[model samples]
Target: MRLFLVIFAVIIISGCDDSNSKPSTKLSEQQSSSLLTIKDESVIPETEFSIVFTPNNEVEIIDAYIEGVDMYMGRIPLFFSRTNKQLQYIASGMVGVCSKNEMVWRIYLHYRKNGTQEGKIATLNFVVTNT
Candidate 1:
């Protein structure tokens, strides 16, 4: 009888846990996309820059592609920062070679919430210049 009571108490306490409860405030679980751009006059090679992308809803980056001169020939490392809410990319040395040219980066983002299937492509444009 004591064992049965202890088991019942454990189950009751576990049931009171609210770890699976929904948040008090509702968060919109929609899919959306927006363009991220840099207004700098020049993007120096071998430098790292933070690219910010704001979506209408929370989303995670899927993949990225960059185009401009030979910028795509080499590996352009990308780091995702959730705290700062930005994506950091290292400019390849080819950027300076592509000076006076336009560099475009496309990022694929996906929103996975509320059983909704939504995706967005964020485009970023920058001008490679030597200052």
Candidate 2:
């Protein structure tokens, strides 16, 4: 009977252990930055640059694409990486080419927050210094 009692007590103790319980996801979740950064803001076409993306929140997946906003360049897919909370990429500069002195490119970002099926989109624009 004593052994049975001890077993029951152990079960009860384990059941009431809050220390092992996972914290609320909503509590730890906060909005992150959508637009990351480019090492050089004065971007030059066909030149590579270091870019980073910080999603608005933890995400399961993120996909990005770039296209010319001021000229004719079809949407081109881009690949990047997520380390901790930041996504890094070495962009192969702008594909936009036109008669204008400055070329404009728009990046469309799509992401799915961690533990969710709902998706989000962010739009960022940059100019190429046709120098």
Candidate 2: regions farther than 4 A off? 1-33, 84-96
Clashing pairs in 1: none
Q: Model 2 compared with the native: what TM-score?
A: 0.60
Task: Write candidate 1's Cα lDDT for 7-114 as tens digits.
Answer: 334434422111111111111233223434342334444344444444545556655434443244332334444545443222222121332233333322333322
The candidate that achieves the highest TM-score relative to the unseen native structure: 2
Q: Give the number of colliding residue pairs in candidate 2.
A: 1
Best by lDDT: 2
RMSD (CA, Å), each prediction: 21.9, 24.1
lDDT tens string, model 2, 10-112?
3344221111111111211123345555545445444455555665566654777766676645565666666553443344433423445555666666777
lDDT of 2: 0.51
